[model samples]
Target: MTNYEVRANIRVVFGDGALNELPTLLERHHPKSILLVSSGDYVDDLGIGDAVRQAADSLGATLIEDRGVVPNPRLEHVRELIETAKAHNVDFLLAAGGGSAVDTAKSVAIGLAAPEGTDVWDYFTVGHAVEQVPTLKVGVINTLPGTGSEVGRSAVLTNLATKEKFGVEANNLRPVFTIVDPAFSRTVPQHFQAAAIADEIAHLIETYTADDTDVDITDRLLEGALAGALTNAAKYADDPADDNARKQLHQISLYQHYLNFDRNSDWAGHPIEHVISGDYDLLHGEGLAIVTVAWLRFIAAHKPTKLVQLVSRLYHVDAVTFSEEQVVRGFADHLEALYGRLGLPTKLSAYGIGQEGVDIVAAKVTAGGARTVGNYYALSQEDVRALLSAAL
Candidate 1:
């Protein structure tokens, strides 16, 4: 816990009727045209796309709406979007769905400003110079509170050619503004909602356990953020229209992202999970929920105090009464209870990724240039294989 600085740049407009503020927000930016990106059919079903169109139209800007973003957004699609924005000479973007949509829009913002055909992958791949580039102004109307992509200066996209899911973060990735109106989540189905909750928790876990130097302020803030996310997520699971619950979930997710957790292993169950999604198209959060339990259990002894801290905060349990090992397993049990409550998958087997799939996943992670994963344990390829087997 040395001296450090974290940047919080995106202007966030929260609470109900926030989407209606879009028109006025756009008026300030005053762009000639806007590219609206959405995740899937659900956005149309929920009327989110229409809402953005209405706002963009009222603002007198041509809105080029595309609902082509996939679950794991692809690099080719990003290039296509850049071309679409270029063809229309669109100067602004509105990400109107969840992480995929927001990430795609973010990629487009960077791509359109880069030298033509610069391959968005170049920004993320090793050995390439990721120079600062011009980018479009952006706005967000987020549906899922998962990836924090709305306010984050990062975008994740998969390359089917390489069967890899990678992320790029740059100075230009943050949105100019975001309107987190959870009213849009009122009709979201259970599975997707559960996965988002899992993702939010995963972010909290990564930051909380990544380092153990007792930055008490950071620890408590991360702990509180996890508590808020779980409480509201449980409320929404019981009744989706609980606007208070939804709003709290939105607020808590933003709080979690505001911490700026590292993307490495102990910080994330993600590296292990990323390869799973990259190979099999599993949802990112679902994989995290599945892998995190195994990861936490594996590292519990290595980072006992922090694990105790996390268990105390997330489960509201007395970690002091238990031995280090008991506290560790208790955390896993508590996570299981939360997962069951949210209807999240408990094992890789649930996704039909059996023994052979586990081998493939480990091989991919090792071949993907990760000599080690996580900050605390820094598991090597062999350790990752063992972790994958444990997850299985």
Candidate 2:
């Protein structure tokens, strides 16, 4: 077992009626001004706007609502919100939707606190330390659960001008509190709901593939989470309104982040997808669904041992008798079927991406004289080209 320090600082109010706790949670901060950040019409459709207004009114705080955050969480929008927050003297930021909303609010909070004349993009590009800046407190009413941004310390943003997507992490970026109400989750569009489940599965598997060490407790916990996630995903597919499954799925996403305590997790697949989504404005989860399979195939070919272990543990496959190649095929086949069950497209061609698109994205992945993206596999520029080509 490796030495690790757990920073479990976020206060979580989770359950069926968790949204009602918004006022109580915000009252603890006693802010005079609040910024309610969200994506699309969910704020209006779900009555989240009204709820936030009521909560702010109850606390005698002035509320500024920005319901314009998009799916990819653009840097341009973050800049606009940061200016809005600064102008309003906003003391608190409330994210009222999914991971995109949470991340936008986080970017604005950190951007607002950055030193004078400091471009917020520096945080993502120039290794700016978020802890160095004094950021406004953030709270989340997480209506969508996949990315786990409500409890996570990292935020992903896309720079449309540069066609660059990147993430920044610091303990300070985490929400001070998160309210996970399954009722709100039930209102999510079925497509996004399926995508969210896929995203969580990818997160768990990505972390699991980081190392093949004998950390029995962590490994078991990860396997259990993956199993539970898969089971709930099937129920979700059967009936999107399965209340118990929705609630459990949300819990699985939130809790699984804690399992990466001492592991050097691999996230190579995400950058590949980030480039695709950043350039073409594709859904993050959708791109992930396609790229994750290709990434696994890369693993199966180059580093079969860890993937073989995952199949043996999760699916009860007899790796001892079967060849590694056979185990690889089983795992790959199983994942394709699972993605099919969720109604996700498994090929890049499903999104109209082809050889030319692959060439462009491959170049972008190794841009700025960079050699690789992930730590576990250390995929080279050529490896990235090959990987995207394989997905195509």
Candidate 3:
């Protein structure tokens, strides 16, 4: 038995026109002041800011707009938003974009609720206790489908000053309500949508590849998410206007988070990609797109069983017709082909990262006296360097 705990805390409003329920969701909180967090151009282009303001007006709540959030959510910007929320006495936070915006809002909530004179970054540090930190209520209007920050308790943020990226997990930081409107995904650029699909695939594979035994039920859900994402992603690529495909992908991204409840999953790629993307200001999903294959290749050398099963089931590779090594290569090549077809990066060099950059990222992952990462294979710094070099 895994002996894991499930936290079904977030409420979701799903379907087309779900954004209209933003006011209804906020009304339950009954906040007197609200901080609307998003990118300036995104909110302006989509009129999301105005919609939030109208919602606030309907609820008699004063709205404060903080439009400085960027992709890879910066720590300095989080600090600024924390101060802004404090100055306005914001009782609620409404994030109106994708993962970056939601993460920024979550970071701000953590910062705002910290005990006086305490640094918010401390919470992200390993071994830090975060019980009973009075986090503000957060609501989300998801304009993109990947990352699933809308319903997740973890938030990833970058510290530009230190050139490091870290993730913090606290139950209180999870959004109280999330609006998943498939129509909103249509407004996102195809490039980002492709990366979002890649992110969905990575999340599913990460959980499915865990070394834990007796996770058959969790494995089925993970496999189902993989199939659903792949089928819908291809449909989306063939016809970007397919509403059903978009809706399916959006819902899969949200629902897949629950699959992690009973699994000690392999997430070696995410931390490495986090450091690389934080350093280069790359799209988080695109970084994952590059690292996922390489990480799998490394893990396959040690734990080829799950991946072999994955390719056999998902890509229809026949175990009797092919060797395990060949099947693993087929999996990697097929994934790269899928991502390339979707117009995503398949190599770190695509983003101008090279041997030197790989060396830095390897060092960063092992920084602060850490020797390894990932529960499945436990990659050493040399392992990270070799795989990343091979990726390039």
Instruction: Give the Å error, residue 379, model 2.
Output: 1.3
Better of 1 and 3 by lDDT: 3
Better of 1 and 3 by TM-score: 3
**Tens digits of lDDT, candidate 1, 320-388:** 677877888777877877887888877888888888888777767777446666776677677777777
Best by lDDT: 2
- Candidate 3 TM-score over all chains jointly: 0.96
Clashing pairs in 2: none
Mind giving the per-residue lDDT tens digits that candidate 3 earns over 64-150?
987788788988888888888888999999898888999999988888878888877888864455547888988998988878888
Which is better, 1 or 2, measured by lDDT?
2
Error of 1 at 356 (Å): 2.6
Steric clash pairs (candidate 1): 206-267, 265-374, 266-374
TM-score of 1: 0.92
The per-candidate count of clashes, in order, stands at 3, 0, 0
- How far residue 222's Cα lies from its native spot in candidate 2, in Å, is 0.7
**What CA root-mean-square deviation does each model show from the true structure?**
2.4, 1.5, 1.6
- lDDT tens per residue, model 2, 142-244: 8987888889998999999998889888888889999988888877888888887778988888888776476778878889998898888888888888999
